[model samples]
Target: MLQSFKCEACKSNNQPSVSNHKDNSHLPDCKDEISLNTIGVIKTMFLEKRAVPRQASEAARIISRIELNSRIFNNPEHSLEGLETFSHIWILYYFHRNQIHLKSKVAPPRLGGERVGVFSTRSPHRPCPIGLSLVQLDRIDNGTIYFYGTDMVDGTPVLDIKPYIPQYDVPRKIERQEFFSPREAPDGEENCESVKTASTSTSGNLVSNVTVPNWVTNCKYLSVTFNETAEQQLQELAVEKKSITEILRADPRSVYLRTKYGSQIYTFQLGENTVTCKFDDQNSIVNVLQVRKVVILGDIPVSDDE
Candidate 1:
């Protein structure tokens, strides 16, 4: 079950030899650069990389489907052996859109564009562009894996998959290594104090032994409503009324966008349609102004089978 409490601070396939990505400091004495290939590709609602949720948790209920490269991931019937036994799986993929370069320092949204070491944050601009995510395993059918809670953009290259064993993945007791505490702004409740940081400790880790502030694990989202035209269009499309709401409630803005343009009319790709959302930061209300089917060239224009 989803639990709520505070004190925060947190947070491919191909089957080919992945490039060894060293952090800001690359080992000059180590081997040369390596080559990595895509094991499979993924399909998500995000047609482009504009308003993607920074973390998978921000878009938990959004469904994403993954297909392996048949040329490499053969034996479809047996490929996902014993995968169904677990409730979650790890997705390893490449940042196909990442440029061919590396940066020692980056500005993270969480720190309001504060310059921090590339190794200190999850920025894609790294020595090697790779991604790892843990998603709830909805089910597996044929050679495809259907799951929820993905931050991947459409057509993401998935490299590998592995079952999640609690004993091996989940720690018995979590040490307070995180520097964040959740922000608690509730109905008739004001959010307590928060201290966002981009500094590392002398020991080469994030701020250790930091104070965790009271944060909100969940918030009541304003029930999204549509106009007459949008309502009729939504009914015709057979889209759930809650699907758009969930994304808004999760606050699609990255830490940078939120700090910069929280009141702007945020537009994002939703399936084959475009959704325009205007959020009221004070009351936590999201207004769905428009939902129109758009022509996205890279969009998968069709539904998946099996």
Candidate 2:
């Protein structure tokens, strides 16, 4: 059975904009309430609170699935019409983990602990805890969207999904990228086309496509060849070069840590294992030295560092 309804209580503008200006002042707090429906739930390998990536870019190889709510689960063939044409899709979801707190300002590590208005940054502690992410569309089968590049947690309530169209979405030219911070575009690097955000959450309240910085694409990545021990062990598990590329390219570190640590051992929690590597800034290579099983504390797999 197909069902639909019109909501006039809280009107939302879906058009893309530089800033989100939602006028909620008119509605009285005493009587105003807006309810949103959950269309699906996202299934991911990231189970721990800290295990998830800060943004979709870091989750390039992270395969996840979106299973539509059984209420709307019937007839995937009709519901997912014309969606296969696009290579990427936008996912709007609720940040279930961020419901505990809300704040107006936060210290963003990207700026070395500088305080900024919460609205200006992508911190999870905001007025609204909605999260938006762009991911590679693998294929939709039996009403499940199997995708890569997810930044959300397990059991996330998905509100909606939309295909990505580059023609209308990408702007021809920009007057100035003043909206971007200096840390995003360094002083002497070629004017980077895109920027990598260390955003923790979103306000589907205001959402858009995820764009990776051109610098990241152009950055030198040394050929990754495993040591004899690593190669022998990896063969048993059958890991691919493509998976390694996807994981390392998206710098997996806190904004504050990635900025100061020139040469250090960084570990990432992927699935049941912890990948430990040393990043060589001079040559711009990540040498994956070892992979070990993550220790379970409570119900989540934890890295030794944590």
Residue 192's lDDT in candidate 1: 19
Give the number of colliding residue pairs in candidate 1: 13
Q: What does candidate 1's lDDT look like per residue over 18-134, in tens digits?
A: 133335253232336667667779989887887676678777888898887788757664788677766889998887887844778887654556677787767776787888888
Predicted structure with the largest TM-score when compared to the true one? 1
Error of 1 at 95 (Å): 0.9
lDDT of 2 by residue, 1-306 (tens): 112222332234333222332563434233345688899999886664553666787668878999987787667557787677668899999888776346678865445466778877666666778888989999988788999897877889999998764433443333255457354334334221232121112223123544544432454334444556555545655655456555565455566665678668876655666667777757767677766656889987675547
- The regions of model 1 sitting more than 4 angstroms off are 1-30, 174-232, 254-262, 281-284, 295-306
Worst 10 residues of 1 by lDDT: 192-201
**Could you say which candidate leads in lDDT?**
1
